[model samples]
Target: MADFVEKASEKITKLSDEQLERLLNTVREENKIYDSIIQSIPSGLVIVDNNWCITKINKSAKRYLHFFHLHLIKSDPVWNLIADEEVSNFISFCAQKQNTNTNEEFSIVSADDKARFIVVSILPLVCDGKIAGTIIFIEDITAKRQQEILMHRMESLKSLTNLAASVAHEIKNPLGAISIHIQLLQKSIKKCREGDGQLPDEKFMEKYLSVVNEEIENLNKIVMDFLFAVRPLKVNMTLSEPDSIIEKSINFFMPEFENCGIEVSVNLQGNRNRLLIDEKLFREIFINIVQNAKAAILSSKKSNGKLAINSFIKNDHYILTIADNGCGMDEATCSRIFEPYYTTKADGTGLGLTTVYKIVKEFRGEITVNSELDEGTVFTVQIPVPQKETMLLEE
Candidate 1:
């Protein structure tokens, strides 16, 4: 006891009380700053101790792990807590090779059959020339991957541009001629009625012209879809309110809803909503989703079809729910619902929902669909708002 006291006194006697207090305060401030930086990172971080047990996890880390806020301590193994077999294996392998740090991408699939693409980097934490622990940093690369795919698709389309022009010209030229001929026939029929007391086949002419025009319109839409699929999508983000955007979209489609004998409803849900999104792209998102609902309703031929849009805030995202009482899809169809050129309609361009899915993902958001055959369909859109949920911690 005397030796310990002598050593402690020798270490501290050189510094006055004021200097010791100042040193203690500086250490505390440094620790606070460190914790702030660790939690502020967008990537998920998991810290595992030398015993291969979880020591700490950040808000983002919990999200990627599909594990919400839980007070985990050093005694809990990271692999045991996080139930992904692949993730567990990776962590175990890194623990075995404690001296080596590694970075790898992992594809994690959840119970809902939804796939998440993430990149995991396992870095060994060094302390006093030995491995103290391992730090796992996870980042969502889905948006980056989506952009690469879009760029590839665009590149492929460039090779087909000449053929696109050729096909468009050939298709439109005949349609143009047919339109002109139909107009002339209509005029001729009028003249015949005036020149002689002869009745013309008004019903037959009208029916034939209607069919021709409808077919012409369908062809034009397909051509346009091809052109648009290749066109570069320019996204400019702005701070905007979701309810305002939804209102504008509802106004534009009110006439269609009424004409189609569908009832439309919109609930802003208290209206304190804001998200960082591309205004033009978000408006287009609304238009596509609402139109899809209309199509589903019309196809189902439901006498009491109703469309409802409700907006609210959840977590750190602005949630928009667009639901319809119409023809819904089965599991098989839902699997590839976001794929390009996947459509349920006979005359659909198949790009409407695909466009919506792409834009939502581009803005770091997600689209989820719930439906059953012949019942109804609901689309839930979650767009992240870059706002801190808490001052000291984020989730």
Candidate 2:
């Protein structure tokens, strides 16, 4: 009885009623504010004690669990919620590591059963120089991953282009020499056969030589195309008028349109926006898009397919729209059209639009397209206005 009374007296002496009440109220308010902020954030946050026991979860984390068909409960194992074994292993490894928490990437299946990419960061919450708990922050990165893939594709195309240029340069000299020898041999054979009235199987020999010559020509054309695709030409910087550039591109492709029985229309209505563009590259971009449109229109089953090139200045930006009333592309194709070596046209190198995309990006411009199957296709290119001034040549 004496020992129990003594313990009670010590407890009462250590704590003041007002101090205990104030501390409790202050802690409750702080917890409420922390919870409010965590729930407000879009990123999923999970708080766990040192034992890896989930103590607090935000609404976003609950939503993520519902999406992934996982039930979140008190003391739920974080590893059980994670779908990827590698991620689970990583989490365990991080938990074991006393210092230097790491960020890990994981793919989780949502309730819709779609794989969603997320970057998870584990941060240790230290109290009195000892880890008290950990905070796990999950950031949805699906769009970022898609962009990364696109950038990777671009890198691959760049490397391929460089390799193609190297190979073309190496083959050109040998190919030229072989072509010269072939021409000389053909000439010598013709001369000898002409001298000998009875040509020794000249017909068969001529046919054989013709076939060889045709094959060589085809190889040469491929080489030329590769070289053209890979060669990086110096840009001739000039203050170019958008209207003249359009006019020149149209003029350049007029003959092709006539030959293909396709009608070409140009609507240049925008204020003459002066831009610093490499004339040659700009022409190539315009020509490629126009040529593609012409071909598409020509091949369309419709008797009269139309191609239109419209350029206008809008809000300090030069907006150019190229539309073709031809068999248009589906959504899948439009998404991949800018991709290198992706094309629907037969005998297409698949580099035309890619080249256009590259040039537009270099100029800090943007290009986008809209197309519906059998309806038509429209591509919009917005070129920003340059602050620098230069002399503009009139056509």
Candidate 3:
């Protein structure tokens, strides 16, 4: 807090010498009042001199920036606290800008997984028509960003629900015919080889058949996964071992992880594995998250990859968190991750995470994601446990 005070209001008439001296003494005693008001303001306030030195900073500014005022003062450049060059350039422009107040919204990720969106309005103070200093007002908008993400998810769920039946009717219904046709073609090829009794370029025929078979199988799997994603929730919720479910899901992707040189660790400590959850639905959720982690690692082009899974009981909920050392995402990608048909992968259908979100919601669970680009990603899930007495009473 600074001892600076704004100019006295001009409500007084022409006063005698004694009256003027009394008013001056009163103002001197109220200097701390201005400091208190500045410190109590919710928005961050920073005042910089013409030389770009941080002359006055309020408490909110220090808290928002996650820095101490002491570290930034003492003739240190103001822009050094902000890592981005673009932000620094804007600050410089704001300080020198004359006769105008500039407003801008930018995001800053601190030393944590969360990103802070801040709106800055820089007002230049002019002294005798010359640029003197700047007053930067900062407001945090992180909650606004989170609200936008929630709205996007609601819209995505509506779209997915409306399209699910039509897609299944148009494509999935013909899958049986497609599979039968592929089998017929295979039999026809076999007969041709048998009739000739002298197969030429047999390796060529085999390779072509292999590629076609693999693609058809891949297509069939994609359709099934999509249908599963759009399927109505009819899970059989019962007492189940959570660790077993985790292990089973990991087993499904074990070969792929090993092939990619990815090491995975699972910690089920304090996780009693006693929960009322649908085993199949749990498997589906784990598969989607684990596979995406693998895809992220592959995209990073790093020498090695790591996947860590930790589960524990917190309060009345079972919490699970998965961390990966892989190609992380920016704020935009992270926000839209749970939306249907929004994917970072070139070959991804983007319904995978959407399905996971749907299942989690059905189970009355909460899920969150944190990522840093080029660093990694982490997903935390907390599923509430129902009381045994309440269930028995219903019966």
Worst 10 residues of 2 by lDDT: 386-395
Residues 33-67, candidate 1, lDDT per residue (tens digit)?
Answer: 87899888988898888776777777777767665
Off by over 4 Å in 3: 1-231, 390-395
Query: What C-alpha lDDT does candidate 1 achieve relative to the native structure?
Result: 0.74
What tens-digit string does per-residue lDDT give for candidate 3 at 64-179? Answer: 66543456565765776555454565676655554246565555654454556666667666689877777777887767655654664465478685566765665654565566
Which is the better candidate, 2 or 3, if ranked by lDDT? 3
Which stretch of 10 consecutive residues in model 3 shows the poorest summed lDDT? 386-395
lDDT of each: 0.74, 0.70, 0.72
Model 2: lDDT of residue 118: 66
Q: Point out where model 2 deviates above 4 Å.
A: 1-233, 388-395
lDDT of predicted model 2: 0.70
Please, what are the lDDT tens digits per residue for candidate 2 over residues 1-395? 34544454567557689856755566677678878998999988888887776777788765544423245634556766665565566677787664335565555665456666666677777788887888877777767655644574465466775667766676776577667767766776778778975544777567656766765775776676566555554544444676887786677678877777677787897566667566788878788887777777777767777888888777778888999998888989999998656789889978789889878765557899999888888989998765322222321
Ranking by TM-score: 1, 3, 2
